[model samples]
Target: MKLLSVNVSKPKTIAYDGKSVTSGIFKESVAGRVMVRKLNLEGDGQADLTVHGGVDKAVYVYDLASYHYWERELGRADLAYGQFGENLTVEGLPDDQVHIGDVFRIGEALLEVSQPRVPCFKLEIKMEMPGFSRQFLASGRLGFYFRVLEEGMVGAGDTIERVKPGPEQMSVRETAHLLYFDYDNLDRLHRALRIPALSQGWRDAFAELIGTSEGAPKKPRAAARAWQGFRTFVVDKKVPESRDITSFYIIPEDRVPLPVYLPGQYLTFKLAIPGWPRPVIRTYSLSDGPCHEGYYRVTIKREPPPVDPSIASGSHYFHDQVEPGARLSVAAPRGDFYLDPAEETPVVLLSGGVGLTPMISMLNAIVHVGKTRPVWFVHGTRNGLHHAMCKHMRQLAAENDNVRVHICYSRPRPDDIKGLDYDSSGHVSVKLLKRLLPNREMDFFLCGPPPFMKSLFQDLRAWGVPEGRIRYELFGPASLLTEGTRIPLRKPKPASGAADFEVVFLKSGVTARWDPDYDNLLDFAEDQGIFPEFDCRSGICQTCMHELLEGEVDYVVEPLDPPYPGRVLLCCARPRTDLVIDV
Candidate 1:
């Protein structure tokens, strides 16, 4: 295969569909040679490092030949090299020919084929075509990803010569087929797993398949072991954090040691209220450090619906109805939004309102772990009455000279003293941040309301903070960290000719017509008087997961973590075809 063009671009945030997303997909064809590095091209960068641009997926390559296929398929001649967001647009290489572990020399650099490129929603934005990602995957034209073996300069017209073939000799086509279609073939999967250069993600999937075939592993990270429906827990203590916020310390009835959860992880509680017909499942961040054994602390803000009294009744129930000694059904802690214990960089913890719950957990962890990394705890609330954990935070800061606290009350009371009770009196704006922050280079962790998060995200970007350095936790629906701007809604495609198509709850013995108004099957099921077990309706907890006995479903919003094969998270999925779910 011959390199036709070398494309590179720094990620740029764009306003699309009503969200702000940083995408590095708009690669431009460079005129001259570009230096390829271990992580990425010298001129290129990934928007999110968690999923993209690692040692396993340093460079993305697409076949220029496929552009011809897409040109004919789309009936458009506007297609160009690097349009598929590929760093290296080659002439001859296709998805079928490349193998995982195959090493090739292009220009002065040596690259190893690692894995198939998994398409995300960014493809739809780049192509300006709704549902383009599904089409791209279905087309089987997924380009291969490469890891840089040697850093060197590469340019257009460079010839790619294979220096070594893969150990398994499994073609990229076969791997994709095994992954998506022929996943049941244990023999083929075993062979594919032998490839040393195969990506961790793909390797994990293969291991899962092998494990499933030969009795699934007893302890898989994807599966919850301690969770069995929801066990009863006693609210041991109720301590008021603020006037409106309270901390509930809950202990298991068995009084066993609780599972160790990372700092910033949350516990999902299933609350059975007096008035509500169905039990409410709401997630609250574990406020206290894990060092405190036998019990978990959740700081909850008594949220009252301002415009309508119908919302957040769970918070209302927790504040008014629930008290010490109350039996509450609680699920095991689960969340991806956690402070990395391994991260050694200077930390900046920012919060607004009751968002300080997870930050306090992280801070306590930093102290407990004996980490001396410089920490800045900055918080914003209305006043002393609204602020929670003030004494605890101050005491922690006093104990650790490395930890600095800055509290900003948006509306301070007459009794609140400056530099004593509070540091400042204003909203947590960028101006205040600039003054308080020693530097803009620390690892920033932010949590708060939509408006607060939106402003801070934009401000951080403006301050040239790398997206990878900024981590955040959203309270609900994964909508707080808006990924992209809202594009015009596309017209719904006509339904296939099957008027009887409807979701069938196999065990529930209920069938319901699919409604577009309901964002997911969980909502639709609730509307049908069938409340399937659920927590973190955002799809993080995987509690609502059930067997997809038959038919197909599509995710309106993709889960934070993918569920195991044949299982669907009802919270985020909707019936695409008539679905038979073991609920």
Candidate 2:
């Protein structure tokens, strides 16, 4: 056996579908000897640590036979020695013959087989074949990943020698096949579990299979969607919460038990206006808790006129057009921002203005669940005139020993009392939070206007609160927040269809798979945790116009006027093919 080449590379970011994808998969061969470490070879690094780069999968070894096979299969002869992103390219140790726990020596380095190289999306990108990962796995010619048992200098053209054979004699190909394809092979599963050199992740998979075959417990699943498409619901009652904000309680028209949802989740509605050509869609937070099973409540504030006429507000239609006894097209409740009622961690619910909607839901759910987690409900508004649910907020704190309510009136009215109206006088700042909070080690949930959310997020991080703990949902674009937050609003909505189509947001550096659930690109981008600002969602305003960088799009809603040259109105556009939009 011989080592053909030694490959090394650092993580590199490249444009893919208009988004940036970083990977260490683009490896190039090294010239001279290099030091082999426990984690990786010299000058090599993995972009994401969760899946790649560890003591076990330290050095990936791909044999030339598999390269030859792929070259023939793909009808391409330009494949390089490090094409498969392997660190060490070799002539021997074909996957079918290389056994797990087998020891090998190349130059002065000693290594042991730990696992088969599981191809990720990076491999598909590397191979330039969209479904190559599945094809590679099914082909059963996957190369092996080895862990450094002894670190030493190794160079290209070094001779490879098998030091010891694995005790079980389970080949890499057989192990991979047994785990991914041979679910019914109980004996092989048992034998594979006994091999000590196999990675723990592989062991867990085999154990899961063994348990599944023997009637063991399965893992829990995520909360699922309640209904498909749209269902009609009647507005049973409307109550004024504040000067402008009103709460509407809507019950399912079928009078069935509504699907349970966690606190902080929002509901989308399709509103039919008098003169609009299409239905106006709006998303509102469920202001009430899940404990109220009979009806869902949305507290909406009547919005003033926008600076742009086409950016006409939806709240105006709700306040003026819709009323009790009106039927509305309601969709399944969905939003990634939510409070897990069962979690015992202390939480701080922070909000400003109408942002109090989701906070109210969370506070109610927390109290209803009866868990002893400490909660600090902090709210800010101009004064008593603008604040909603004052009595309820005070009552929740008065009744619950663990719950603390702190209200801040940014500009309190002359008539508003000192302690009775609000507990604090300024905006809800990190300095204010420090005074109210006992320590800095609690989960913080914030919602409000963009400025309010952004400042608080930056302040919290600066004060040493981990980003993971500082959860928030903003009123505007996720672009308003700093980079690396992955859209502070919520997690990207999962793709609805198996469609291979992808929309790349160039400025946002995000790629969203097309979901047929959305009628236009604007809604699809929003669902995928992208923030493309739009005032009129029906393509009348031209507010959501973005450059069409790479692909063609079809108009779902015809614009009021012709679009700009080379620009598409996202609110009216649906991707006709794979798209790259200059956001």
Estimate the TM-score of every prediction: 0.50, 0.50
What tens-digit string does per-residue lDDT give for candidate 2 at 1-583? 9999999999999987557989999999999999999999999999989778899999999999998898889899999988999999999889999999999999889999999977766787888875466577678888989989999999988999999999789999999777655543679989988889888877876776666455432221112215665788889788999999999998766443355565787777877877777777677899987733457999999877878775446798888878888899887666657786557889999998999999999999878867789999999999999989999999988999999999999999998998898987999999999999999899999998877888888789789898889888754445567655543434445664544589899999998778765667876787677777786464454668989988888886445456888899987688778999998
Best-matching candidate per lDDT: 2
For model 1, what is the C-alpha lDDT against the true structure? 0.80
lDDT of 1 by residue, 1-583 (tens): 7999999989999987667978898999999999999999988999988678999999999997789889999998988778999999998788888888999999999999999887766777889985576567667788989989999999999998999999988887788767654544789999999999999988987777666446442222223224545677889799998899999988776443344566787777777777767766678999976533457899999886546554346787889988888889887776656774335799989999999999998998788767788899999999999889898888988999989999999889999999888998888877887897778888988899888887887678668787778888864443334447332112345544553368888898997777665667886787688877764677766779999999888886556457889999998897777889998
lDDT (C-alpha, whole model) for all candidates: 0.80, 0.81
Runs off by more than 4 Å, candidate 2: 1-225, 483-583
Q: Candidate 2 at residue 123, lDDT?
A: 84
Cand. 2 Cα-lDDT:
0.81
RMSD (CA, Å), each prediction = 23.2, 22.3
